[model samples]
Target: MKKILIVEDEKDLAENLRDLLEALGYVVVKVFDQAQFVLEYLKTEAVDLILMDVMIKGSMDGIKLTEEIKKSHPIPVVFITAFSDQGVLERISKGKYEGYLLKPFSLQALKSAVFLALNKHAILEKDLEGASKNSLKIRDKGYVVPVSQDDILFVEADGLYSKIVTIQKTYVLRGILKEISKNLDPKKFVRVHKSFTININQVTSLNAKELVIGEHIIPIRRGFYKSLLGLIKLN
Candidate 1:
């Protein structure tokens, strides 16, 4: 079930909405009268969707609160406000809202809005999941070793075999450099030299022709030097 957050100043209306949402089979994680409360809550918990009333307590209205929430958490939002004020509607139009429900809306109308918002959110979450497949299983000996792309520090092409180095240990598997690198994320792992491939995250420091990871000093080949430096953004 999709988790929803209700931000409404009206106590009775908030409870009614919560009950209605629960009846519809969606999980109402919590309700807040103030936008500030929601901000604090979001710090610890993850919400799938937000049902925000346009008008609320505190200086930050629902729209502005949504903007703040979006800076870090880009979740789907549905506006459930009583007033269709021109200014509020304009702001809502510019905001990342999936649906808008006018006050005095029927339970069916509420259901439609929430259902659509969560459906859109579900698709987005699915896409995100597909993009974050940053892990690989290494066929080491009879057993298999699972490793995260981010955890891998470097790989050295050792003739017929490749040496995989992680934060903790190193494994020499029977594979060529090109074959072994196909399992890693291309964006995070790059060939710095003919024999060395380093993870972008593992670079501790770099100079004109070399990068250091842990105690290993990987040389930057003349052919790959410029491209290697361009890929890494050092502070």
Candidate 2:
């Protein structure tokens, strides 16, 4: 199920919204009169979207909170309000909200807004994943080579640099394994060990402790053994 965080000051309305969204099959976490608390939860909790109210009783208004959240979180936000003044619309637009619902909105309107926002978020995420999978450029004034994720059979960390092994070629990079792992698609690539990140699709065979790709052997860390199997099956 997709998780959502609802931030509104009105208690009765918030409860009603929670029930309505829950009935629509969305897991909703509602916050009343506390934008700061919602912001903190967003840092650690996994939420797919946010429902924000413009006017609220808090240290920071909803507009500020929305701006801050958008900078760091990948989740989409929908602004809900009964007031439809020009200034409010300007502020909401400035936040780049996925959708906006004027006050006294119907249940159907709310449902439709949430549905479209989620669809847009999904599209954006897929585009980002595709872009990351297609290219990995050097981060610094080093030999910047664009390595296709498909061409990379595996990556082995050598100090601060990683040695990328492909089906027909190999290259060295001046970044750590964790740094490279961020740009790799989780569906296709996985970190099998602290020192190695392997493309699960390229893996020819796997043992209890090592993955065999042609003549090369990549060690699978004890803690990541189950995850490795999951990735292999996923790919």
* TM-scores, one per candidate: 0.59, 0.61
Best by lDDT: 1
TM-score of 2: 0.61
Q: Compared with the true structure, what per-residue lDDT tens digits does model 1 show for residues 42-100?
A: 99999889999989999989999989998889889999898887987899999788899
State which candidate has the highest TM-score: 2
lDDT against the true structure, each candidate: 0.87, 0.83
Please write out the lDDT profile of model 2 over residues 1-235, one tens digit for every residue: 9888888999999999999999999998656567778877877787888888888887888888888888778778998887788998887777667988888899999999999999998998899777765877643345456667888888899999998888777787778899978878788888888898888888887877888876889898886666677667532
Candidate 1 local distance difference test against the native: 0.87
Deviating ranges (above 4 Å) for candidate 2 = 137-173, 176-235
